[model samples]
Target: MFKAVINVNYKPSVLDPQAEAIHKALGRLGDDNIATVMVGKYFELTLNAPTIEAANDQVERICDQLLANVNMETYRFTVTPLQGATA
Candidate 1:
């Protein structure tokens, strides 16, 4: 088995309203010095592929097909073997 940790976030050119709000709130709470913040999605996927290459391929497909919006979002992922499981 393989474990995939995926992160999906907006392109740097896009505005992140949620992040901006959080940053402002933090400042109001007396925690200053924050220049910016960004929101994103994190996913943990478990797969039972035969090899690391196969697992990576499946995750790439998943990210491109559903996990990320190609027009506005970018994504990266890491694949690692789960302890005691064979892939």
Candidate 2:
């Protein structure tokens, strides 16, 4: 078994409205050090496959198809075997 951890975030060049709002709110609260915030998505996927390579391939397909918006969002992930589990 394999577990995939996926994270998707906005492109740096794009402006984040939610972050700007929070930054302004922090300023009002006298927290000027708060520069910005980026909102993102996190996902954990479990797959039963013969090998890590196969599982990773499946994970990539899923991310490209659904988890990430290929135009605006970028995603990264890691694949690791489940601890103490039989294959």
Candidate 3:
């Protein structure tokens, strides 16, 4: 077993309305330390595969196919090996 984390975010060129709203709210609360905020998606998944390479492959496939919108969003992920598991 392996632990994977998938992070999806809007392309840098795109605008994020959610993040903008949060920024505005923070300013209202007198928090001006933040300069920019961006909204993104986070996913945690557990995958069963024989090796780290296989686990990474599976995560990449899912992210490319479904988790992220290639036209507007970009994604990154990390995989960690798990202990005491059998496939």
Best by lDDT: 1
Candidate 2: tens digits of C-alpha lDDT, residues 13-80: 87878878888888999998976778889999988988999998999999899999878889999999
Model 1, 2-85: lDDT tens digits are: 999999999999888998899999999998998888899999999999999999999999999999998989999999999999
Candidate order, lDDT descending: 1, 3, 2
For every model shown, what is its TM-score relative to the native structure? 0.95, 0.89, 0.93
10 residues in a row with least lDDT, candidate 3: 78-87
RMSD of 1: 0.8
Candidate 3, residues 1-87, lDDT tens digits: the string is: 999999999999999999999999999999989999988999999998899999999999999999999999999999998777774
lDDT of 3 at 38: 84
Q: Name the lDDT value of residue 50 in candidate 1.
A: 97
Off by over 4 Å in 2: none
The 0-to-1 C-alpha lDDT of every candidate, in the order given, reads: 0.95, 0.89, 0.93
lDDT of 1: 0.95
